[model samples]
Target chain A: MALADARALVPHLPAFPHDPAGDGAMLMRAVEACERYTPMVAPDGEDALVLDLTGCFEGQGWTRETIARDALAHLARMGLGGRAAHGPTPDAALALARFGMDELADLPVAALALGAEADLALRRAGLRTIGALAARPRAPLAARFGRELPVRLARLLGEEDRRITPHRPAGAIRAERRFAEPLASVAPLLDVIEGLAQRLESVLARRGEGGRRFDVALFRTDGHVARLAVACGRPLRDPPAIRRLFSERLESLSDPLDPGFGYDMARMAVPLAERLENEQRDLACGEGGEAQPDLAPLLDRLAVRFGPDRIRRFHPRDEHLPEYAARPVPPESGPAAWPRPEPGEPPLRPLFLYDPPRPVGVVAEVPDGPPRRFVWRGKHHRVVRHEGPERIAYPWWKHPEGRGPTRDYYRVEDEMGQRFWLFRHGLYASESDHPQWYLHGLFA
Target chain B: MTDSPILRLGSRALSAPVPKGRGVIGLDVPEVDRWLKGGLRRDGLHEFYAPSGSPPGPAMALALLAGMRNCGQGRSLMWLRARGGRRKDGPHAPGLAELGIDPAALLLLELADPADLLVAGVESLRHGGAGAVVLELRGRCRALDLTASRRLALAAERSGTMALIVRGDARPVPSAAHTRWQVSAAPSRALPANAPGHPVFDLQLLRQRGGAEGLHVQLEWNREQAVFRTPIYGDPPAVPAGRAEDRRARRAA
Candidate 1:
């Protein structure tokens, strides 16, 4: 049979059950594996992959025909049947795969085309062989079949006149499943999310890539779409990390995802990916050298429960006053380093520092030293050993609310071993009749 | 003949065999190690009490990591269980690396759930060929019973690893292990001519297996080298008997 006759049988092929697209994924994987042999490869529709082995063939000391035979053998091992032809262009190889006059000529014309349109074209032309099609004038055939036919024909003849463009694979993989039943509660949805995340992770692992952002789509029974997306500060493959990120976004979902009938389906996709290398650190010595505690996960959970905007870290501002020294910032948007206190500063710093220092009343204040006695939390306590009057002045440009005040912080040890970090808010200037004292944090 | 009897008594006292080989170095004060049979046992859980208002938690944890880095070949993994609570408020990664630990070898597992933290701890202990496991919890871990501790101990023993538990203040004692220490900030020392100031800590040996008990050691942390060293103490002034009495009373009060 001639090549054109075989090429014409493509449209009329009957669909095979359980062979949708004739194992496209398997074929792609096999082709990708072959890329180590040569970088240039193109898919011939659904069933075949074409490799440009011109430069590679010489290095292997094999003729083009011999290399084609080895490629077919490798495909056979992968349970795929294919025919290869060495042509100058990708389009030519594809055409040759369809209708080359090789030993594969015994395969039916319908098998080569793989569908019905080719069969109809062959019948209309009354062409039985590729030789017959080659006999026709190029101009008429181009007019009758449009531009693709002659271009494809020229490629098959090893003419380098036409260029073949290969399709690029998707940068990231995505899969979606529409449920027959809508999910109403959090439990079932969590199960689906877990499964989806696992599948996405496996795909990424195979590609040697990790995802930093993922999007989950919830298609409701009422035809509404609810999409959630989460981003990680770093690329991660650990399922727990992915789950935690998703949980945060899920909690903040605004339009109550009511499963009217239920969510029809959930689709998970990796929109962005990055290559990540594993990290390693040296171990500490002694019992103290054991693992240190990580607070990120807890912060993530808290940010999910409370809105992300509500949670913040106290960053010590580069200022003198205790109240002006610290600012609240979103958990995600800050440097990892916590600001250090200056030398000769007050000894005591509170572990749990409040945003705005709460006010208290002080009975006696000595210049250049801590308060002698103070009323805090509705009680009186005498300072035994007091340090400081570490004076902190405000930034003149960015005045705090209800400011016009400078603070003198003191590290006062109570009768007990317990210590208190207190500061007088206003200066001793007579212009301000009332000076306020505030309690900031407690020292361990 | 009387001298011979005295020599025999002296030999017996020396032969009682002081326990001092097990406590973790660079962590327990010399006196605390004397009580702990050495330092913290090489393969057991050492719990720390971190009250909300305590500075000792971060200080002790940093000291522990520094010690482990000194002893072990590779990086250490720290499993933090609470958010915002386990801030590496002091001694960030770079600071730790300068202290002879490879920062690249440190693996920080910041997990949200306590169950996940436990699982990671077990898995890391089992597979992570690192030297130690540190768990920072909000309160006492009632969940970590004797059985769990034994399992963790067995894992550590098999891997020749160590586990440190830093529990928040108010947590009741969970399970007994090799050593337990409580830490508190001592007092700050004056800065030198132009150097950054050092943080001073009074590490009290609350519990130990064999060494001295109720011992206090003062340490000054050098920020630049990321190392800790004993500070020089001034000479003790001679006091009048009445003044001495007053000093004792004030201390007791």
Candidate 2:
């Protein structure tokens, strides 16, 4: 019935517009609560979550039914009403729980969920229950109501099984702690993190490896998970060092962590780890021994506080174009080297390069000549001395029909002794009607 | 002593008269090293400003100085630049390599907020592992007050690393800097074909904490030699390249 007709019939019916998007988002968040059970928790259309709890029931002595019961209990605590069921396959379990059917054989033919038309056709053919649909031959059923009717029947009847694609990949090494009395403040988080880090160190030490990146998750009672991550310059296994880095991260958060109503659980995972060899410390002559201070700690501290992208190092590339010649990367991540300059010559390149080289009005030889004078930013500079037309051709292979025009570069010095690297964009008549001049860089 | 800025009491040059405990290094110029009392103090803070109207000279000078602190010491150098410069492109790597500084070893710290530039500068200064720290504040930095400079100087003193700050479009302000200099471009000596020669700078010692100021000098940079020297004037006329030999004969007559 239309909402207007229903309103007229009832006179006063409190109603709201259907919001599928909001409902979908809320369902996904509610599904996150199942991640505490297993990482292989996946949301199955509109209102259900399918969990693949393979190998999760060992040692704890809890069966699959008990796990589902616990999940439903947690959902109830979060103010969400849900149904729990166990089946041989994800489809069977979803159909069973959604239809509130205890026995699979008693489920209606509509439980196959092959669409309303297929359901109506099957009901007209006297197949009103899933048992009746299963009793019929699959070839006739496929021929009658398309090929998907039989497959949906098989999956809904626990004959076909496939794994669920997990919402998140489980970490290789992780530690979690649950408290009976939820922690109400953020003061002891570092201590808790240090304790977790110590647990992770033993496993890493045995494997002869260390963690380079760590992620911590705080599970709140209100179903909100707060996550923090930090990366290190080197593979680190020391608990105190890891704690220190996290302390810096915690202090620099734009919005401080809020343990709304308290956090009930905390977990730490080493998402990325690398091999690290043992080191020997020399007790004697420790001061000024090699005279090199360890800079990794300080760099990691700064990187955490300000951010990794803020600290960068230049990596020069082998390219014909000046703009692509160099790039900045995170600190110490580049090949630390540079080519030696040509001897017995003034520096050809300017100290600073202007991107989209600034345009200038110039007066020079008509055919092809070095600029005699040029006006840049409305200021005139008379070129007292200059070196030519170091012609650089554009990279032809980079374009389909051949791209940009050749540039004629010049290193010119103005009367004030200021040096500039400018260029003519193209040849006078062949490439363009009139070539344009541009200032590329400034020389100190 | 004469009233001229650089006092040549005798022909022989004197070593910098530094205090008993402190160490100093030279820029390979005798007059400049002497005028600077000893030379730049190892654990000190120095400031370099671009001349009022000039734009490009001081940055290159500071890069050359940073190269001095980078090479032969086996220690990496840290350079901090704020992200809010008016210019689009950053320091050209090939240009830095041409000026004798290794682009790879120079760690570039780009701060998103100009306010964080000083904090990063002071942190890098206190790290003690770096050979030197160069802070590039392109314009007037309101955060770098006397107190902040003092904090940077103290950090530099604690760790034996040097601090150099380069300002692009800024006026001289009161700070805790040991030596302050102004740098601007001068005419380069012409080469064989009237081409611009090595970079020459007209530098002035604007102020020194405990020494003299207003000492002006024209110095040229030699990248291969990794030193600064008195600029040499070329004999060839800056122009008349095409009528060269005939003009020389006429001038000789």
Candidate 3:
């Protein structure tokens, strides 16, 4: 027990300081690397990892034993030793892998990961193996050893189940391919993507559905993963279109995909799916048959290159304020019908409106009459003709900041034939004695 | 006044694909028709340049766009722009409706990068699903040089989709556009002392592919008839000529 005796027993022993942070970070890298197997890999503890292989391994024609063996081999290559086991539940598998093979009956109850004090108490009671503890009467054990004893015993025997949360959400459908030799070029990778898309298309077709989003993940030989995803405006099952979208998506990536080493495996998954019904096309009328043109393709390409937010259509909002009357919504939203104008009538509003009303100096004859002259952008303009003093009151309940008397809007034409939409912010008597005028919009 | 809709269109007709082809839409004015060599060809790019310190280019662009929309039936329009341009605010729907353009038939894309806007505009032209594609770019976009303009022009020609690029407060740059015009607001014909009339524009033909250049025209938009007209034939004065001056002189007296 002396330091000299221990050193003499193992004279070549290496020692280093404890590094919990380094160990934790290494464990996280291992977890990320293991995602090549399944997206649902999670770090169980400091030394363990949990993978939910519910429906994934079966698709590859691999049994649970092979999956475990492959996982252990993978970690071994990473310079870390690991033990893996498959059970009916995560708790059961964890207990078995740490203790021994199916010989769970002979292992000590301490293998259940119970706290040290409880384990020592069970040992003092002459309960050596899990079998001895499980053989005891349920009621007496609960009363004497505590409630956790029976629960732990049941879980170890695969009677009770425990849930494990995956680090990443599992996709609805997935297809993958592993190559004997790693691929380095984009052409072959794109071919693989096409094949995977076809596979996904069949899967979607069988389910009478379509995929709205597709994610392609490449697994490098050096344990790195690069993922690219594309979204469609409508439910899509076409392989070529899906491939084209992926190509566009790959080009649009800010950080280009780099195969540091080489990619060993590639996978495609449909994370979001929607129901789509097939429709017939009119050949005679051809492209002109549809009343509203199909702009979805154009919209999708633009959205992928730029962003969905950059491309949009206007929708009517239920607001009284001029600025709030309309809002930009996604292109998928149906646009509201514009009000039609009667023949021989001047425009109701200006073609372009200033987002934030620009302030302008005004000179008026009467207290509440329309502006006779105005100064905009340090330029003077004489109002030759004026249309209205249309009063638009503020919705006090909605906007407390705009809680004032009604705004008087006038459509006026200056001497230069330039028309403007200007409004007085408040009234003379109620809100403010001297109201301010704002240049709001311009006429066509 | 003519009973035949075809007669109303006069001898100049749009390039017809079929014998009854409605391919090219005209501005219905013989002067502009002769100037444009049969109105604006549907299969090309039109550039409208509003010079610096002017407010009329945007208005003229809208009027021309309204006229272009009249050519195609049930055809939608797409307008693309950069986010931080001079007029970042989008077109008001009510205003567009008053110009005879259904806002429902329009798609507006506001992008941060001018390059993306140009690319998207060209791509939209290629699709030809929309009747026309309009790009509102202010100042100079390095990405939209002569080469990009030519590419867009070719795409529009190939697809038969009318393309219009409206540059605000920017001088004419080297472009391969089919036609280029400089537009500025001009005072309307003297009306009654205080009455307003139709909008008037002083339009100068800066460049045209195979047509005469250096031609100037004073144009007015007839809101009631929804047509473009030369100012030579003016409508009855809304207000008596010099009425405002007469009133001012009277007040002075």
DockQ of each: 0.05, 0.48, 0.36
TM-score of 3: 0.85
| Docking band of candidate 1 | incorrect
Candidate with top DockQ is 2
Instruction: For residues A114-150, write the lDDT of model 1, one tens digit per residue.
Output: 2577656765787555556667888987676566666
DockQ class, candidate 3 = acceptable
DockQ score of the complex predicted as candidate 1: 0.05
Model 2 chain A scores worst on lDDT over the 10 consecutive residues at: A283-292
The residue-level lDDT of candidate 3 at A83 comes to 81
Ranking by DockQ: 2, 3, 1
> Which pairs of residues clash in candidate 3, taking residues 3 or more apart in a chain or in different chains?
B191-B239, B192-B239, B192-B240
lDDT of each: 0.54, 0.79, 0.74
DockQ metric, candidate 3:
0.36
Mind giving the per-residue lDDT tens digits that candidate 2 earns over B147-194? 999999899888878888888878989999888877777788776667
